[model samples]
Every structure is written in structure tokens, then in C-alpha cells.
Target: MTVLLTVLAGLGLGLSLIVAIGAQNAFVLRQGLRGEHVGLVVAVCAATDVTLIFAGTAGVGVVLERAPVVVDVVRWAGAAFLAGYAVLAARRALHPGALRAGTEGARVPAARVLTAVLALSWLNPHVYLDTVLLLGSVAGSHGGDRWWFALGAALGSITWFTLLGVGARWLRPFFARPAAWRLLDAGVAVVMATLAVLLVLRPV
Candidate 1:
């Protein structure tokens, strides 16, 4: 019963953090709508979150909490990755046919999609704070049953991403036009760039 309660608490916290509209979610939705590797994208996001949550529950998060230099390194790397992705997104927007052509020709390479998803999920400071620090701290409060809390948090991530990807895919027909794709890509580019700037400016 204690574990169940802890799981519920973790679920609530994880959902609260993830449900917000952010660069990560925006990118996922855009990719899903584009009929990209939606399942792979969702799986990567969920798996990354679960892994971090597990680490946090296992007390690795506490070690990271005390390592200022490590945190700084992660922050900078994440910012650089996001910035690079933003540039790619902008270029895609400008060219217009690149993404569509890629989608048409070769199914957008599973490895490339997985790498992008990993970068988006693992490289973000917000993800660390939300899944590793914040959720981990909350789970740690459960004493020996912290794993239950981590399980709950993992469930939240899985549920949310699955829903987002599946739901967005259902809207594919509505957003099938070239102009719509261009608008979505442009929006993704702006959000990703803004997130990169914010991450860079954040105090280490």
C-alpha cells in the first residue's frame, strides 16, 4: 500500500511536469504529425525518462546533486545539442521539401530518429531536473520504497508520450498540406531555438 501511494504521488508529479507545452513536447507532436517514426520517438522519450527516474531512485541522483561541475557540463552539452537541432529545423523549414522528401524516400532512418529523440530527451536540463532531481527527491522521501515512486513516474512518462504520439498521428490528415507542414516546422524551429537560448543563459 505504501508503494502504491508512492507510485501515485510520483505519477502526479511527473504528469504535472510533463503535461506542459514545451520544446520537447512540441517537437514530438510535430514529428508524429509528420508521420515520422512516431513509435520510435515515443519509445525513446519514455525509455530515457524511465532510466533517469530509476537512477534517481537508486541514489545516483544524490551523487549528481552534489556534483556542480557535472551539472554544468550536462547543461552546456544539452544547450549545444538543442542549438544544433534548432538550426537543422530552421534549414528544413527554409527548404520545405527536405523533410517530406526524406520521409518519402527512405522512412527517415530509424537510427537518426532515435538519435534525435535521445538528444531531445537526454540533453535537456529540464528533463534532468524533472525526472532526476525533482522526481528522485520526491521518491527518496519514500525511504526503502523509493523504487515504487520511480515506477509511478515512469508510468506517467510512458502514458503521456504514448498518448501524445498516438493522438497527434490521428490528426495527420488535418495537417497534410505543404503549408501546414511548413508552419509546423517553423514553429518547432522557433521553440527549439528559444529553449537553447534559455538553457545557455541559465546559471550553472
Candidate 2:
């Protein structure tokens, strides 16, 4: 029961952190809506999350906690990255050309999508904090069942990405309209801006 409880806690916390509106989730949703390279995108993201989670479990989390400077640096970098994405999203929301540029977005190359997936996953420092550091520390608090906690976190990532990627097809009709893209980009901008501000102002 103790092991089960630890895993459940990790899963819950992992979903809470990951499911929040952010750049990664926004990218996933876009790829899903496009229906191009969706499987590859989902696989890469889930794999990256699993890698970071285990790295955290193995001791990186402790190292991060000990080095307050490192966390501060990451916090600022993540804030900047998120804020930049917000600007791009806002631009897309306001520009008709930008929204219509990739109307047949299905033709986008797999390599291009993969490159973006990697950039969004690795370039964002938030992943390191949430997946490696935060999850690691919490898992360690579970004592001997830390591995189970990590596993649960991995599962949460897999499940969330799979659902987000596969289930996005259902909204295809809505996204078929230019107005939908405008609304989506606007929402993405707000979410990104909020997260960036929170990152900068939050106590490390």
C-alpha cells in the first residue's frame, strides 16, 4: 500500500505540473491538430520526459536543490524563452498571413517537426526543473519507493501525451476555421505570458 500510494502521489503531481498550459503542451496540441508526424512527436516527448524524470530520481534533483544559483539561472532562462514564445503566439493571433501560411500544415516535414519537438523539449529549462528536480525531490521523499514514483511520473507523461496527440483529431472541424486558429493563438499567448511572469516572480 505504501508503494502504491507513493506512485499515485507522483502520478498526480506529475499530471498537475505537465497538464498546465505551457509551450510544450501548446506545441503538442498544434502537432496533434495538424495530424502530421503526430506519432513521432508524441514518442519523442514522452521519451524525453521519462529520461528527465529518471535523471532526477538518480540524484540530479539533490544537486539542483543544493545549488540555488543554478535554479535561479534556469528560472530566468525559462522565463525569457516562454516570454518569447508568447510574442510569437500573439503575432500569429493578430496576423492573417501568419495563420493562413500553413493552412495545409499536413505537408510539413517529419524532420522539421522533430527538430521543433527537440527544441521545445530541451531548450525550455522548465522541463529540467519540473521533470528532473521537482519530481526527483518528491520521489526521494517516498524513500525506497522512489523508483516507483519515477515510474508513475513516466506513465503520466505517456498517458497525457498519447491522449493529447490522438484525441486532438476530434477537434479537427473546429480548427478547420481560421477563427479557431486566432482564438487558439490568443489563448496560447496568454498562457505563455502568465507562466513566464510566474516563473520570474515566484520564490525559488
Candidate 3:
């Protein structure tokens, strides 16, 4: 059916957008390895993304698209956040021993985890441009059953984050090694810094 094809297309597109080693995914993996509230973090990330995708599909993204100034503000803010996060990640990478000797069994508060996930998910302009404008545009092409397209996109978010969390958990043994953790922290730093530079250099 045409509807089925559209939904599949949306799913594919959504997955492609999210299946990257970016700040969000790196943070989720780090928290998961730390034995933190992995489920809550993944759920919050997925749920927040789904909400934004729905808003975009409902034509809210069009209104946002019309306001260039608002988009500019979000862009600059996201850039700044990414830069700050990059600094923290770089610091961690440079001093992995400090984190290694700390309370590995320590639990982060649910509220803090939720807040971090929400900020990572919602504060990025790429989130809006990808989920809202881009995905919404694709979904809008589905005519009468656009909601199905949105559902498929939402499903993509849920599937990806769930898999990431579970997969990271399975890799806990590998991450337990000090060298491995150091490499991961360094990778996170590089990814975040790259994203931050890209965001800053992006054409407004």
C-alpha cells in the first residue's frame, strides 16, 4: 500500500538521522555503561523526540520555519551548549583515571538524568530541523494518512534508543577497562567538538 510505503520511508529516514555517534548517543552510552538509569534516559530521549516530531507533523514546524530569528537563536544556543559539553567531555577524556577511581556504582538522580536527556534532545536546532521540518515535510507528503507516517518516525526513535541502551549494557564488560573508557571519552569529545564546530559554521 502507498501508506505502508510512506511509513517505511519515514522510518528509514528517521533512523538514518539518529544512527550517528553524536552527543546524544554518546551521552546515552556513557550513562548506560555507568549503570545509571539507562531506561529512563532512553525513554526520555525517545519521548521528547516523538513529541517534537508530532508537533512538526501537525504544521507547527511550518510556523517555526517562518520565523528565521527564532531558528537563529536556537542555533546559537545549541552551538554554545555543544561547545560547553565538548569541553567537559574533553576534560573527562584527558583525566579518565579520575573518573575510573570514583564511585563506579554511584547512581545519578532520576531528575538529573531526565533533565540531561531532555536538554540534549530538545536544545539542538538539528532536532527541530530534522524531526520537525525535514521529517514533517516527508510525512506531509503522505496525504490522508500522514499520522501513520508520524507514528513510523516515532517508532524509529524508540527502536534506536532502546537498542542503543541495551547494546551498550551488553558492552559493559568492554567499557569497564580503563583504556576502553578513555577511548570512549576521547571519542565523545571528538564527536561533540565536531558537532559544535559544524553548528557554529552552519549557514544561517
Report how far residue 24 has shifted in candidate 1, in Å: 2.9
Candidate 3: list runs displaced more than 4 Å. Answer: 101-105
Question: What would the per-residue lDDT of candidate 1 be over residues 88-176, giving only the tens digit for each residue?
Answer: 77777788678576334566777888888888887787888888888888888888888888898899999999999878978777676
Q: Give candidate 1's TM-score.
A: 0.89
Candidate 1 lowest-lDDT run of ten? 99-108
State model 1's lDDT: 0.81
Model 1 off-target regions past 4 Å? 102-105
Q: Go through the candidates in order and give each one's C-alpha lDDT.
A: 0.81, 0.85, 0.81
TM-score-better candidate, 2 vs 3: 3
TM-score of each: 0.89, 0.85, 0.92
Among residues 3 or more apart in sequence or in different chains, the pairs in candidate 1 whose N, CA or C atoms overlap within 3 Å are none
Candidate 3's residue-wise lDDT over 21-102, tens digit each?
Answer: 7889988888877867888988888987899889888998889878988878877777778788778767766775555543
Q: Which scores greater on TM-score, model 1 or model 2? A: 1
Compute the lDDT of residue 199 as modeled in candidate 3: 78
Candidate with best lDDT: 2
Which residue pairs show collisions in model 2?
A: none
Residue 24 lDDT in model 1?
Answer: 74
